[model samples]
Target: MTESALLVCPHCNAVNRVPSARLDEGPKCGKCHQLLFDGQPVELTATSFQKHIDKSDIPVMVDFWAPWCGPCKMMAPQFAQAAAQLEPKVRLAKVNTDTEQTLGEKFGIRSIPTLVLFRQGREIARQPGAMNTAEIVRWALSKISR
Candidate 1:
């Protein structure tokens, strides 16, 4: 039997069932008709955050950040670049802690630039700090296996 992956659409918050083997074939959301992988991180608010992590078969990497933090600002571009390279396989997302303080509290995020890797709604690994594009990519790739 062929297995399918459940992906939550970053565009319209719709859930899509994609064949595991065809994940890289540029699948479009059934409801929104938008490309699922757009080579950009999804800007997630607290309301939309739970569904993405819980429903997505692929790993979800979240950058917990606030706009006023220097390190978070510095890593924003690098995070975006990493998202461009890692998409379709992994869903990259960002949560502005300043706006989503409840999410920050729920996740126990004490730092401005924290990277959390989640698979099946469970956190697998976490890194707190700013990293360059290469580092971010490498770190995420390494953690996905766990």
Candidate 2:
């Protein structure tokens, strides 16, 4: 039997079962018919956040940020670049702490631009502050491999 992984659609938040070996083959969502990995971080809300964390078989790298933060703004492009490199292996997402205050409180986010890595519905690692593309990718991969 082929190994399959569950991936939550970033666009529609629909769960999809995809063959593990074919992750880099550009899989599309069954329900929404959208490409699963678009080389971009998904914008997640409080309602959709838990589902992605709980359902994804791969590690989820969440950037908890606010619009007013300067470091957050600087890291946005770096995060997106990291998404392009890390997709299929990791689900990169962003949560606006300003809008999702409840989520921020739930996660006990003490600072802006916090990078939280979740696997199998549990947080495995977390980093506070901004990082460049190389730093983000390296940090995420290092954590996931542990």
Candidate 3:
């Protein structure tokens, strides 16, 4: 059997050990049985953000954006494309600065469309602005080892 790695479920917040080979096989959470990767960015609330960043073993890329920001709207599709291509290896998330103001302030995000990359609960890199899918993937991959 292939070795399994610990993965924190985005749905039920359960820690599950899944075979590495099954990473792309639509693996479900052991406890809640929800599909692990839904191929979409996880919308993060203030409460869930801390838990997710601290518990997840994989690298997390969070897009800090607000509905009113035109740049953020334009960048949304690129972020989604990157998320879809980098599934099972990287976790993509989004935080609405308008709603989750506390998180935005805490992160010192003065600009919309800021991408923060976190690993092991600590932020490693941050970029403020819109980036194409290739640039997003390149930036993320540069920070993490494959």
Candidate 4:
């Protein structure tokens, strides 16, 4: 049998099929040939946010932040660290509330540092506030398998 997994291209919004066994090794996008997991949060717009949530087979954690939010800025480094540790297992994404207002409203995000977890296109959990690297990692790990 053929094993297939979903991967959302970070450079372009292309959904590519990746083999399950090759996920940890490193997977490249079929269209752009970019590494699927680059240890950075995927910058998501309104359109891409919806697409990624629906198309990604793995669990997604989205950081809802705004440019002017001080806490959001302070949490960036921690978020990046968590993303690096969780690579190839879970997808880390960021939604700028300043740009993606529609997506922010769609998720009922009232707080600037809200982190929403999505799996199979549905919201599984959400945490509101700026968390440290360990807290963020624990929260994300609680929702996904290693």
Candidate 5:
């Protein structure tokens, strides 16, 4: 039997079981019927944060940012590029601190552009600042290897 991983749908918050070997083969959610991985960072809100973060068997990397921050704005495209490069192995997500203040407060986010890596519902590493696409990929890979 092929091993499978539980992945939460980015669009509808439905949990989907994807074969570990077929993660890159485009899995769809049973409940929502939406593509599970889009090779882009999923938008996270206060409502969807817990499920996606806690339920996923794969590592999740979140970018906590505020629209008003210049650094956050500048790094948006870089983050997106990093997401495309990191997907299937890692799930990249974004949480707008301006819209989700509660999440920001819960995470104790004092910076505009903060990246947090979570596995099995617990945070493993956090980087507080804007990073380029290459830097983001390097940082995420380095931390996950540990």
Candidate 6:
């Protein structure tokens, strides 16, 4: 029997059940009719963040950032690149600390550009700083098996 994964839609916050064997084949949401993985980081808010983290069977990597932080801005493009390289295996997301102060506080995020990797709704490891695309991808990949 083929297994399936529960993936939260990045665009509409809809929960979807996708076959694990067909993840790379490009699945669409049954509700919004949107592609499940669009090769980009999902912008998460306080309301949607929990659902994505708790429901997704795949691992989730979140970049906690703010608009005024220089390092955060510098890492934006690199994070996006990392998303393109990591999806189907992991889900990349961005949470703006400025806008989502509660989430930042809940996660104990003290600095901008903090990368938090979550598995099964729990944070496994977190890194505080800016990293290039190569570094980001490498770091994220290294944590999956842990």
lDDT string, candidate 1, 1-146, tens digits: 13999999999999999998888899999999999999899999989999999999999999999989999999999999999999877899999999999999999999879999999999999999999999999999898865
How many clashing pairs in candidate 3? 0
lDDT per residue (tens digit) for residues 84-144 in model 3:
9887888999999999999999999988899999988999999999999999999999988
Question: Candidate 6, residue 7: CA error in Å?
Answer: 0.4
Poorest 10 consecutive residues by lDDT, candidate 5: 1-10
Q: lDDT of each model, Cα atoms only?
A: 0.93, 0.95, 0.89, 0.90, 0.92, 0.93
lDDT value, candidate 3, whole model: 0.89
Task: List residue ranges in candidate 6 displaced over 4 A.
Answer: none
lDDT of 4 by residue, 113-138 (tens): 99999988999989999999999999
Residue-level lDDT tens digits of model 5 in 1-146: 24999999988899888889999888988987888888789999999999999999989999999889999999999999998898877899999998999999999998879999999899999999999999999999999888
Off by over 4 Å in 2: none
Clashing pairs in 3: none
Per-model TM-score on C-alpha atoms: 0.96, 0.98, 0.91, 0.95, 0.95, 0.97
What candidate 1 gets wrong by more than 4 Å, as runs, is: none
* Model 6's TM-score against the true structure: 0.97
**Which of candidates 4 and 5 reaches a greater lDDT?**
5
Backbone clash count for every predicted candidate, in the order shown: 0, 0, 0, 0, 0, 0
Full ranking by lDDT? 2, 6, 1, 5, 4, 3
Judged by whole-model lDDT over C-alpha atoms, candidate 5 comes out at 0.92
| Total colliding residue pairs, candidate 2 | 0
Best by TM-score: 2
What value does the lDDT take at residue 31 in candidate 3? 93
Minimum summed lDDT over a 10-residue window in model 6 is located at 1-10
Ranking by TM-score: 2, 6, 1, 5, 4, 3
For residues 46-127, write the lDDT of model 6, one tens digit per residue.
9999999999999999999999999999999999999989988999999999899999999999988999999989999899
